[model samples]
Target: MNQFKKYPNFLIGFDRFFYRKEHKSTRRRILSIIVLILIALLVIYGILVATNVNRYAFLSLFTRGLRDQKQQQDFITNIGIFTLAGLSFGFAMQVKIFNIGISGQMLAGASFAFIITHYLAKTGFAPAVGGQLITIILSMFVAAFVSVLTGLFKIYLKINEVVSAILLNW
Candidate 1:
């Protein structure tokens, strides 16, 4: 019914690429997404304006820690610690297990490590790297043992891990 009808392949391909072939459905979806994003931005802008916050430095908080060497080291250490915990959680989830005792296990391990470090410091091993390494290994084993204990209870006692973990966490 038109001149472009003679070149069906090119017209169909062009329409699909430009999103003009979906009866405005594709265009409407994109337009809605843009509108929602714009709305969110406007709300954030309004809150910032109402608070009279310094707009120029509002986002500097995110990068301020990187400006200090010690803070950067602390940030990286925290990242490493959290990544290990996250990996453990992911692994448990993959095996159809919910490891809600993670927090308890981590706290117990840290406390054990602190006690070991304190004793080492008192026994002339003050700041010894080897002692620190041993302390870390011991802490990891204690944590794993505690976590496995919780799993054992779930498997044998038929107790919900979440409920047991809540008690353990407390």
Candidate 2:
């Protein structure tokens, strides 16, 4: 009987939590979520303990960024862009507007930024902040302009934003 072979609490706790009081547990919902998370961790650990390799693989994913500065910086930059995109999409979602052309907006904004920076570099006109603030402001304006076109497609052509977005994206 391996000490690690007989863990039933993870499964049993969840079964009990859900089926224990099926009809009257609204008040315990928050507590139940906490319990579920703890149980999930226990379940993940229990499954991973089957091999030392699994343990190493799981831990490596979390520690690699801490060990590599370049990887950490790349991760933050990529995540930051997606976070901004998500915020824009999420706000549109809240208003019941399905603006699926967000990608077009982002691409247009990036192009605008690239043009501004290229001009700044050519003209030898450098701002105190590396002209980054100007690039950001111009990018925002471009994105807003693209979004307005998307809205126009919706209102004037009665076209689905997704369709116009795909066209714009291309």
The model with the greatest TM-score is 1
Instruction: Indicate the TM-score of model 2.
Output: 0.63
Model 2 stretches with alpha carbons more than 4 Å out: 1-66
Q: Model 2 over residues 1-170: C-alpha lDDT tens digits?
A: 86544877876866776657766477677678787788887777777886545677667766777667898898899889999999999999999988888888999999998888788789998777746886898899999999998889899999898888888888
Query: CA lDDT, every prediction?
Result: 0.81, 0.83
So what's the TM-score on candidate 1? 0.64
Q: Clash number for every model? A: 0, 0
Which residue pairs show collisions in model 1? none
Task: Give the range of the ten consecutive residues with the poorest summed lDDT in model 1.
Answer: 13-22
